[model samples]
Target: MHTTYLRDLYHLHWPKVILVMLLLSVTVQEAVSQGQGYRRKHLEFYDDKPIHYGILFAMPFTRYAIKHNEQFMTGDTAYSIKSPTKAAFRMGFTVNAFLNERFDLRTTPSVSLYEREVRYSYPSSPEKIDKRESTWIEVPLLVKYKSQRRVNNRMYMIAGITMAIETNVRRGRGGGVGTLDTKSTDFTLDYGVGFEQFFEFFKFAPELRFSHGLGNVFQPSQNSLGKGIGRLSTHTVTLYLNFE
Candidate 1:
């Protein structure tokens, strides 16, 4: 079991994390070399503007943090439950308002498609899967703190809140039984850090962000499948590439 866990940890579950770390390493090394050079800064006055616009591209790894209800302990059908991380893509536009030399307020509005799942293991039967597919329209209001630029690279940290509304949700039944359902709305606290690399035409930043849902998303169950679940909250880790 331990070996299997290790295999999944590196090979199945954390590919995005590995990719992000590798990219961050390469980008940081490149930034160090560029900063050491006495080259002219490309967008020397880009920050002088009060407002700016950009596009966002990201890969989000999401999962549900589950808590068991009384039924889970009293029942005999399902012996265990597990939730795994699933990867999804997002595309959005960034609208940024400059507040000072060190701070900027930004909003990124995007539509995301998600496939999140929960697993149930039976005493003597095959493992069952409950999958939820949904589309969300999200707007994140964030405040960014920027470090002074060196040559063309800068570091920034962002923290804020995100409001998400569910749309086009397709809920499916597990084993012809009751289905799992969630609320139509979600609120999360978001925080992250990034490195900025300035170019001749645009500024690029690679950011890693974390989001934790503030409210329970679980809906009351009509059958035993969902009755054993007490709370369900969203957790997402995302790697974003921003271009301005």
Candidate 2:
């Protein structure tokens, strides 16, 4: 019975015992007598230099799903019934800092351009509608985790929230004919994963990453203008050259 209990205890508690031993070994070291006094050290502690501040440029590969299409500024009624294939483009710049080798923080301000086209057929008139486009400027704050840190490189993942202000919007031709405005503000959540390779000269890092927008990019409408019109989120993929 005692032998069976010992075996069962080993099965249940061996992993925890090993982990505790490993952690203690990493964080504590025996004191050594050096001439006059004894000094203790932590074996797994290493401090890297600070990341002063830097710039990041990004590009996003993006696509969209037009929900509640009938309520949008589309010229074609048929487009409200069907979805189309198109990719949007975005560019961004950020100021970032590394709290340590394994953690970082960044605030990025970006501009994005989007275009969607659909053919609309009028019931009474035999005519088809042409083109439409939208653009916005957004800013995001992100916190990142570097999975592993080497001499000059690290692989990381980032997640954060953003506040975006919109400007210079053009929706279809004759979209802003009279008393209609197409500008708005949006708050969104962003998430992504990427790799960063840093070089010694000027602290430049070449990185590849993706950013996804989680909220609609349009303002709430009071009438038929934006009723039932779902928010169109955006995405971005880019390579960055950083300096700190």
Candidate 3:
């Protein structure tokens, strides 16, 4: 059943997955064929510039990393907690400042829209699902380390910290009577690896990044539902497409 559910989820996002795979395949082929010296390199002097600018579009799958309190074991046997992940979209602007030949400082400001659900299952009662929708404005400061450029392709890694402010914190009560409150702001540490492919007109980078919240986002309230959950933190995996 778990496998079937995961398969269905993948099918729902097959278009995005296929597009990423195609980009990767094309980049690899271009890199390999360049060794035969059949094609001239594009943007040969692109990196020599002191500053570069670009825009990025990303798809992120986000979830909550839940920590349970002692009440979970001693509380009502009918209560259980389950959190599920959901996919979302983000668009941003990227500014890169060349610090050296192989290192760069980058800042990306983006807005994210996503939804998350926390479900409570009860044997004697109907299941309850609490849905939280948020709109976040996030700014990430990253340091990118690049390998030596080979022909028109290069590989790089980036690590950074992001500060995000939640603009909307609406909660929907579904089969549950209480509200789940979250903090207005959150901080996260992020890291990722990417391949950069340079073309005549621009540079294209496809990256896979992971982010973990540094602080607990759960805001305790008087509600029983809030008391049941001990701590909640954000976790995300993002696929990014950047054009420079």
Candidate 4:
């Protein structure tokens, strides 16, 4: 009777003892592996340089933000106006000046091609499109704020101002009868967020940025197309791919 009772107790508790032993083994293995495996950081001293250069490629979606006058509400010709979104491409080079571990002063000079449009709808006719095409030379001075680096990545934020000059302006032949002229020089406020990914030989960063024109680009002309518009400013969203 005693041996039979002891055997029954062993059978009942053996499963629980085996489960506990398995769990403890797994926990010890994980702790040991974590303590042994250490990640090697990529480009461990990249930001230690005082200055670095990079090339940039970007795609920009642009629009004309218009402020209309009273004529738009009570106009004889065009009762409505709209500026459609257009996309363009740009290329540039970066010049960076490192101030500290967290901050840097930078500039990128780029050239972009733009095709902007304004559409007018009349009570009596189909829509008229006013198309203007030009090339822009832009220089942006920016301040960059960087986060603590991970193993192979870092995050950053940038804010700055841009100076742009319009060149090679042309009115589309398929456009409306008159032209809506814009000023050559403009200024914009730019802000963006980016991430830097490191590799063995170089670093690549991807950024999304926004730009708002500080000055009006519209050149006031006594034309039927822009008669209802008082101000035209530029708005842009760009995706930048950078290589260093």
Candidate 5:
């Protein structure tokens, strides 16, 4: 009787254990097959083309690097000089020529509209602010170095030079004081990093760039504000979005 009871127990549980083992094996095999079939590559042929064209829009914050003259230290009444950064807009078209797999030469021509302010504080009176506005036609020539594309994204660094011609300059007058006078042309050194994303239709890149003027933009005149300032150079930070 004991032997018969043990035989019946073994027969009842053996099929359930086999069924669980088979289901687990099937699930693992399906997962392995799906993993082997998945592909990570997107826009696999994007870099094969030699040249490309694109449009870019940029937002820039610009300021002046002010150098104070001897008057700032000697004069008792004029205590401090400060220039604050201001935001601007830029829109342009891009022309890219590929030199090789890792390098490209680029030129972008754009129009920028910006405003800057210079503030002066005195010991006896309230602070005075000088506002200046400019509309500039800018051209930049850059060399870009890119890393190997990984999946759908890549990283790049760019360095270049830019020439900016100010087409219009506007100023305001207050308290019988005149606005700042600046040169119409400026040359800047540009350096930046960008991240590129490739999709089926196009490539998109967003960049952050810094520009430092190599030339002194200050135009000195007999005016009190101009005479007190020794040197003024342009400094700008720009964020660019490009579609190619």
Candidate 6:
């Protein structure tokens, strides 16, 4: 009975899963090939030697949904975002060193900027809204693995640890009256997998990466509204541009 139920669920969700896998495979193959090609050609131009510097520009491709998943602590007193679902954009840069054709070490330092808005509506009163714009600078040291160099690009995978500096986090109301500034910093674990395609002058790779924060970014125990909402970590996805 359990096996039958598992098979039924798989049949229902298999289409989406297969599509995602296909897309991931194609893109990663293209990216790895491109990265390999660029390294070879650039090295030939500079005294038949290898170039260690690889530069990539990345941005998140996914949409931001609602923070509907609640973290309830002590009944209705816990804090949460009261707004509907929304989307956000994040971008950053990375520079990597080639240890070999299939293995490399990369230092990815990025800046992400986004805004969060929380609102509450009362039965017979006006809605209360709170807004915050935050930016973070993160550095990740990654070890990358790729398929053998070939004319057709191979897929690549990266695993790394990221140390993030929460450069600036500030909040202000719609009228810009209630404003609070928080300069914060923290650490995190970063992991991602993607593929690259090699063009004549540039390499393009769309990567899906996730970073989980290790520490709280907020200070003290009180919030802007005197309600205690602990610090929240940032999460992102990035598309990378590689230049040799």
Q: Candidate 5, residues 141-226: lDDT per residue as tens digits?
A: 99999988766667789999999998875443322336777888999999987778777788888777889999998877666777
What tens digits encode model 6's per-residue C-alpha lDDT throughout 100-200?
Answer: 76787877666766565545444456656655566767788899887764553446788888876656633332223344233366666777766655555
What lDDT is reached at residue 6 by model 5? Answer: 54
Regions of model 4 farther than 4 Å from truth: 1-37, 170-177
Alpha-carbon RMSD to native, per candidate = 3.1, 16.2, 4.0, 20.0, 21.9, 8.4
TM-score of each: 0.88, 0.55, 0.86, 0.80, 0.80, 0.62
Count of backbone collisions in candidate 4: 0
Q: State the lDDT of candidate 2 residue by residue for 1-244, as single tens digits.
A: 0022354345334334443553443233211123325333222233254444555554344343335654444532332322233445666666667687677787767777755443333346543423446677777788988776444334567788877765764444234322112336666566655544444344544444455556665444442333434655544444444444
> In candidate 1, how many clashes are counted?
0
Model 2 worst lDDT window (10 residues): 25-34
**lDDT (0 to 1) per candidate:** 0.83, 0.50, 0.82, 0.79, 0.79, 0.52
* Per-residue alpha-carbon lDDT of candidate 3 for residues 1-244, written as tens digits (9 for 90 to 100): 0112474366346545645785677577766776687667899998789999999999888888878788776773536676676889999999999999889999989999888777777778887877778789999999999999877878899999999998865544322446677788999999988888889899999888889999999886656776667899998888889999
Give the Cα error of residue 178 in candidate 4, in Å.
1.7
Better of 1 and 3 by lDDT: 1
Superpose all Cα atoms of candidate 2 onto the true structure and report the RMSD in Å to 1 decimal.
16.2
Clashes of each: 0, 6, 0, 0, 0, 13
Candidate 4 lDDT over 112-216, as tens digits, reads 988888887777898788886889999999999998876666778999999998777554422443777778899999998777778888898877788999998
Candidate 1 C-alpha error for residue 32, in Å: 4.4
Q: Worst 10-residue stretch by lDDT in candidate 3?
A: 1-10
Q: Rank the candidates by TM-score, best first.
A: 1, 3, 4, 5, 6, 2
Error of 3 at 29 (Å): 2.6
Pick by lDDT: which candidate is best? 1
- TM-score of structure candidate 6: 0.62
Runs in model 2 deviating more than 4 A are 1-51, 69-92, 113-135, 169-183, 203-212, 218-231, 235-244
- Model 6, global lDDT: 0.52
